[model samples]
Target: MINQDHFSRLNQYRSMWVLVFFDLPTETRKDRKAAILFRKNLLDDGFSMFQFSIYLRFCASRENAAVHIKRTKSRLPKQGKVCIMQITDKQFGMIELFHGQKETVPETPSQQLELF
Candidate 1:
């Protein structure tokens, strides 16, 4: 059993995640440039690319996740589709992945850089 304070503190660490899945057109030169710029923006904003068109980041709370989602929306290109989802860490952990015909290792979310 856990005490009230300990339990409350544990609950403070909400396991929320923000995932950005995008499908942008790259057929034309302008479309390709838009896609590349979108990708770079995500990286610059501390999101780690999970796959070719998927990215994920962990957040301390739902509000923090919302801020990222809003930012993503503001930067979306007018030519493609972008979706954002917030899921619990447990749900994320349940995802199964395979590379080609072999199973692949799970990805650990990237940590933020710290200044000394």
Candidate 2:
């Protein structure tokens, strides 16, 4: 018989990856400060810099992802384009990355344990 623990382990496919991409106007001093502050907020929320304007965080489930997305929206800068996307862990694992002409694998974050 499949146990609850085993069933729980099989649900990893439902895990989520939240990605934020932004292009903020940094020409003016105020614009620059806002951009910096936006980035800081993402970091404070446990997101890691995936690139200059890309940040990502892993969430255990869709509900958890929604919480982070809402937090991100509340802190958005006023004068730039920002996009937030969520994908399942299975989809995220299939992404291919490149550095210049060399292909690279994305760094997989350590699995986070969820405690009820």
Candidate 3:
């Protein structure tokens, strides 16, 4: 298990990427309700959106991730799946690899990575 202290340190500069996959049936109304409920819960909990389907990354220390999962599990729609990914080095690398031409300044040490 990840300790609270380590978790805190890790989150100082990085965040956790949460990916939620909706598995609703063909029923349009149920799908809409589930999406609304899911978004509401995340918003109520202060989670931002990174993309249309992906939620914004949060400062999810190991401790926070655990707590977040525990707290949100029950509130999440039953017709969906949740995934948590820790983004530290990889995200930086991707930014550099993709945005290097557009960026004028050099990337930070922490921003250099082989994978995102």
Candidate 4:
């Protein structure tokens, strides 16, 4: 169980972004059902869809993000793949975003930059 104080502290931060990645190996009845359920749950929990695979951005803290991820993972069907990543503006520049892609390049080097 997570401590309520920890959750509160995390929640004190006012802004956050949550990125969720999910993939279904094969389109099957079970997979589809699981996907639908996951989507519904996310909506119910106040996460807005940012992209087909990305989720919401809101004024939430890290602990809240962790709790949300934990609950989501617990509810997910065992057959699919799901990953939740929480990033803040503070960590934003640690990575660079291309036209619509993410590439790993040295933060200080401009020559090796990858562009979309």
Candidate 5:
């Protein structure tokens, strides 16, 4: 059994979101290939495509988020700019999304059960 207070506290403060934004050059065949591979690597690492050039993943904690950040750095392409940002789950929940002119609710992070 899990303590409700502890679980709520973890979700409220300890959880994190990792967002990666990149602008890679694809002027040549090799460049395009590299960009494609980079996207694939991110997908394999559990990142979801938030946009064509932006990927985001939810981590159980800041430590877990750091590991994903390091993985993202290791696969960065040599020809473009890549930025990674971390935000708490609380901050992420405050994001307001929209489509066209209508306001939309931000996506809820997928539930991730962590052991230890």
Candidate 6:
């Protein structure tokens, strides 16, 4: 028989990864300011820089993911498009990395898994 407590805990381990991708215009003063502000907001909200114009954060659940997405959406610049993706930790682990001479792996989270 399935233990409800064990099952719930195992399910929470799946967790999630929130990826924020954007390409806001940077040619004009206003555009540049908007871009910088967006970056700052992401950092303020706990996202880590994943690459140029890319950021990521770990979300505890679908609701948490929604909150982050809403925050990102509220700050989106007018000149470009931005996308927020939510993926399970298992899927994140499957991502492949390829670069000319650089080695990087998914970050090891410093916080404990959140349960709510």
Candidate 5: residue 44 Cα off by (Å): 0.3
Instruction: Estimate, for each residue in 21-99, the C-alpha lDDT of model 2 and write its tens digit.
Output: 9999999999999999999999988899999999999998899999999999999899999999999888888898999
Per-residue accuracy of model 5 over 22-56 as CA lDDT, tens digit each: 99999999999999999999999889999889999
At residue 112, what lDDT does model 6 achieve?
Answer: 46
* Candidate 5 residue spans exceeding 4 A from truth: 1-10, 112-116
List the candidate 3 regions with Cα displacement exceeding 4 Å.
1-26, 89-116
> TM-score, each model?
0.80, 0.87, 0.53, 0.59, 0.87, 0.80
Window of ten residues with lowest summed lDDT in model 2: 5-14
Runs with alpha carbons beyond 4 Å of true place in candidate 6: 1-9, 12-14, 101-104, 112-116
Assess each prediction's global lDDT (C-alpha) against the native: 0.83, 0.91, 0.55, 0.63, 0.89, 0.83
Residue range 26-56, candidate 3, lDDT tens digits: 3688878887887788776655664466554
**28-115: candidate 6 lDDT, tens digit per residue:** 9999998999999999988999899889998767778888889888888788889889887667777877676776676776684554
- Stretches of candidate 1 off by over 4 Å are 1-13, 113-116
Model 4: lowest-lDDT 10 consecutive positions: 106-115
Q: Candidate 5 has what TM-score?
A: 0.87
Deviation from native of the Cα of residue 90 in model 1, angstroms: 1.6
Query: Which residue pairs does candidate 2 place in steric collision?
Result: none
Q: Which stretch of 10 consecutive residues in model 1 shows the poorest summed lDDT?
A: 7-16
User: Roughly what TM-score does model 4 have, to 2 decimal places?
Assistant: 0.59
Residue 112, model 5: Cα distance from true site in angstroms: 5.0
Per-residue error for 110 in candidate 5, Å, reads 3.1
- Model 4, 14-68: lDDT tens digits are 4355667777544887778878888788877667775586665442456666777
Residue 28 error, candidate 2, Å: 0.8
Question: Between candidates 5 and 6, which one is better according to TM-score?
Answer: 5
